[model samples]
Structure formats: C-alpha cells, structure tokens
Target chain A: MAWVLEDGRPIYAQLVERLQVQIVSGAYPPGGKLPSVRELAAVAAVNPNTMQKAFAELEKSGLIITQGTNGRVVTEDERLIRGSKRRLARRHADAYFAGMEGLGYTRAQAADFLRAAEGKGEAEDE
Target chain B: MNELIEIVGLTKAYDASHIAVNNVSLTLPRGKIIGLLGPNGSGKTTLIKMLNGLLTPTQGSIRIGGQPVGVETKAHVAYLPDRTYLSGNKKVTQILDFFCDFYADFSRERAVGMLQSLGVDPNARMGTLSKGTKEKVQLILVMSREADLYILDEPIAGVDPAARDYILRTILNNYDPNATVLISTHLIGDVEQVLDEVIFMRYGHLVLYTSVDNIRERHGKSVDAYFREVFAC
Candidate 1:
C-alpha cells in the first residue's frame, strides 16, 4: 500500500503520523483539499470509520480543518505546519537514537556516524 | 450511533447438553463493519444463525433496531449463509427476479449492473458457472439489499485474492451508511483492513471484542497472527 503502517501502534496513531507528514512535507499543500474519509480509507485499505478517527485527530492538531460538509482541507497556517514538521523530526530523531541505543551505540556516536555518512555523500559529489 | 444489534445472555444449547453458543451479551453499533472471528466449533455460526432468526436462541434475547428477532427484525436483516441458498437449476436472470419478488428491498437495477460488470451471462444456469463466479454472483445478491444488518458467513472463504478484493469492495460500496455488517470468516488477513472492530470467539464463548487496529497497536501483530497465537494447539 502507499501508506505504510508500523506494528505496535494504533492505526489512528499511524494515520496521524502519515497525514502529519503529508501536510508538513507539502504532499498535501497548505489550503489544499484533503481526500474524503472514504477516499483516504480506501487508499489506506482501512475501514472508513477508522479513517474518520484519524481525520478527527488531525483536526485536533490544527493540521487540517473541516468546514461543515465541505470535507477537510490542509491547514493554511504556516506556523502550524512548521510546528508539526519540527515535532515529527524530533520524534524521528528520538526513534533513531533509541534504535541505535539498542545496538549499544551512544547518542554522540550516532550523531557522528550520521555526519560522517553525510560528508561521504558530499565528497562523492566533489 | 444507535445499537444495531443487542444480545443479552444469549445461548444456544442442544438438549440442555452441548452448548453451541454460551451465554453472551454484546451490543454492535450501527454504521460499522464488525468481524465475527473464531476457529472451528467456536459458536460463531450459531451466534449468526440466532441473529438471523434461522435458529432460535435457547435462552435470553437478541434485539435488532430495538425489536426482538422476529418477522419485523428479519425484514431489516440480510443474511448470506456459507452456502449459496439461491442456487438452483434456473438461469441467473430468473434468480434475480426471484430475489426481487421475495425481498422488497432488493434492487434489480443494482444487482443487474453488478452482474453485467462481472460479465456473468444472464442466460447461464446456476450449475454452469465456475465456483468463483458463482460465489461472486451470490455476493452481489446479498449486497443488493438495503437492510439494516448484513450477516455474511464466510463470504471470502473459497475465492481467489482478486475475487476477494472485488467482494470486499462490493460490500463497502453497497452498504447503507447506518447499517452494520457482521462478516464471519476464518480468512482474517484478507478482511482485517476492512473491519472496524472484531469479535473473537472460542469454544462457544466470547473471547475478545476489539478493533483490528487495537490488536495491531497493543500486540504488534495482525489479526491473523494474533488469531494463530490465541488459538494455537
């Protein structure tokens, strides 16, 4: 499926993450119309009811707005989108560190490894 | 959402001996697809039969739309048994007419439209079509109803993956928004994504009533994987 769901998390949570990324990353641009619950549900291969719950979460976070029966639209507020992006980045970093910790690596080592990998790519470009 | 189905202390026992369905109480809300799941001999079939009025409960009660299971309730519920109850020597079109004559809610245009899409020959006899095609036709019939509760027993059991997808989509497209669809199946993986909630049964007892996503979130496993672990021998 286009939407990948990780294990050990409610679909609502995964949906929130995926849609948050979509909004912040401009896959769903600010002020763009969001797919209806049924459309999104079919795309994700989930029940429409579950999809509704996900949309409700997005609305609560101010990442999407539902204007009566006009359906949902991505929030036009740039600050909200930026906040979502920052929060998502921090969560990703925390997860990366946690996974590295499982492999017996310290936060400093993980950061050094990431920088070294980025430098190698830059050097290849040069 | 109102309670579409309410079962209070429901049980079905044979001769006061073997309990097919133990005393169970549950309320299924409208406008959701609920999976009734279990292994062999888990009272799943019995529970469904009771809901559809095919078999009367030995004790307690089942209420549909605030009314007990009876003639009025039967009108509001559409049931697709594991076997195609409509199979006959007649041609496919004739059977469509039969359903239209029988079920006031059956829509001839919708059913014929689906049949046309599937390329089912209207003149073909029921015995002539392939097993998969016949299953698809039967599914189309069940979904043509505008009933409040749809009880589908093993709708995806024998179909191929492509046919299964078509069947699930047909169900999603044809349901009334306020209706409840209770599908009984062992094919958990194929149907999990479409189910809003799941009811698990074992040995004629209600074991778990949970959402498919809840199972994923809490156990880190799909409904199929969890079923395997829960019913492991």
Candidate 2:
C-alpha cells in the first residue's frame, strides 16, 4: 500500500490513515493479519514507535484488534469499516467545500459541481 | 529496574566559569539503544567522554554495572570518538594488532570480516583511504570488540547516504543484544527509528531522556517532529 504523509499532520496519524485506506480498499481483508510494527515501519521508513502508535490508534478506533502471538488482525466488523469510510468522505467533503469557499464560490455552486461529479462517477461505475 | 549505567548529580566544568556538563542524573538500562541527541557544544561529547574515563568528572560520580567508572570498567566499555583517533600512517593490520593487544575482547576474525566486506585491505595505509572509508574502519574496530557498553559519537557525520546506511546496519548487526549502545548525534530523524530511548541535551544540560514510545504517546508526534518543536526558538 502507498504511504501518504502530510507535512503538518503527525506521522503516526498518517500511518493510521494509510492502514485504514488499505483495510477499506480490501488490501487487508477482514480477519487478515496486519504487518508487524517493525515491518510496517521499515516499509514506510518511519520509526517503529510511530508505527506502534498508529496500530494503537487503529485498535482504539475498532478497525483492528491485536491477539497474542497472532499479532494484529483486521477487525471483522463491517460497521467499523463503513464508519471509517464515512469519516474519510466527510473529511474530503469538508476540504472540498473549504477550497470552494476560498475560491469565492457559493455553497449552491459547490453543491452543483459535486452533483455533476457524482453523476460522472456513477456513469463510470456503470 | 535493570540499571546498567547510572549518574547522580553529575557535573563537569572545564574551568571555574564554564560548565561542560551541568548537574545531571540519569539511569540507563541494558538491552536498549539510546540516542544522546543535541546540537554542537552541548555536553553530549563531554558526558560520553566521562563515561569512558577519557575525562574526569569535576563534581559528581558515574557508575557502570553498579561500580564507579574506573580502569576495570574500561575493559567492558567500547568508545568511538567523533574525531579520528587512528594514526594516518598506520596500516589497518597494525591497528587491528594494537586493538587486540590493548583490548582482551577484540576479535581479529570479526574485524577482518568487516574490513573485507567494506573492500578495505588490512595492508592498506589509513592515509590513502577516503574520509568515509576511514569512518567505516573506525566503526568496524569499535564493533569488533565484545564490550558491554558501546559509546559512538556522530558515527554517520560527514558520510554519504549509502555510508550512513552501512554504518547504521553494521551497528545493528554487530551489537550484542545484552549490551547497551549509546549513540550521540544531531541527526535525530535518521537514527530515531532504531533508538529505544532518546536523551535530548541543550547547552550542556540534559533536557529530556525518555523512551521513544513514551514520547510518541505523550506528544502525538514522531521524535523528529517533537525535536523540531522542542528546539525551535
């Protein structure tokens, strides 16, 4: 999976977001074992403690659960996955609206653009 | 609970006016890699020097393995200074022999292997090698010894990225699991991943010393990020 990091955001939070994206994208299927902290850190070229913090955040968010010896595994709960996706969508929406506002576009104009984009997305899906 | 090295109110002064290391107290345990981080002129070098008996503490005492720093403790300590200590005219073989003679724990086989891997000839004179090669040779010599404490000061400084990787990998591969390695450097981001604990020093005083895990938990930031924030004026 690709590691996406923002300069302003904390490293661990970026890690958590990357892991979440992977999980929601089905790269790490439900109940599948996630990579160890060291392995993830090596892959992302980040500190192991940062990876550990990301894993802990994942656990706290109920997206993953750790089992002794078996290591951390993706949670089997569909609701948790959907919730994360919704949260991600909301964050993107917020950013999109904020950008539109900065560009002097009204809320109605932004909504119209989003609707057109959604229609194009539906056509592509079909 | 497992204190391998301890310092209580350790203070070192070069003169009556200037203090190199202020009243510092800390305990370091075995089986951990510690990053002694600070900018230049910060007492990291002085503190490390005291640990190896290169300099005498002016006021306080340091205990290694429950005993004070002395000649006996020197046997168990391996030190790699920031500056080049080996003579430029000496051959690698001559240096190896000197280490073997002076340190009982020095391993000739390991030194040869490390040198061979780096494409360094034991017969070659130190003066002929590049600066990076010299640093690698120095690291090999220090790591070849089976010491309880390895004090490395700025091992990656003045080297290219590739050499830095090799030096870091060599330290990781050669270090004894039971021993403690204290590395002092200003390059925190590069070595932060491997470090178990980090000690931050500012102007000859230790500002922070805590586990990496604790730092992340408390600050919600990577050690590098936290360092930038802490040191930012």
Candidate topping DockQ: 1
Tell me chain A's TM-score in each of the predictions.
0.88, 0.87
Q: Rate the local accuracy (lDDT) of all candidates.
A: 0.87, 0.85
Model 2 misplacement above 4 A: A1-10, A31-35, A56-82, A104-111, A115-126, B29-33, B87-125, B140-148, B168-180, B192-197, B210-233
Query: Lowest-lDDT window of 10 residues in candidate 2 chain B?
Result: B169-178
The C-alpha TM-scores of every prediction are 0.91, 0.73
Worst 10 residues of 2 chain A by lDDT: A1-10
Best by TM-score: 1
Relative to the unseen true structure, what is the C-alpha lDDT of residue B221 in candidate 1, on a scale of 0 to 100?
Answer: 82
Q: lDDT by residue for model 1 over B141-179, one digit each (tens)?
A: 888988999999999998999889888878776645699
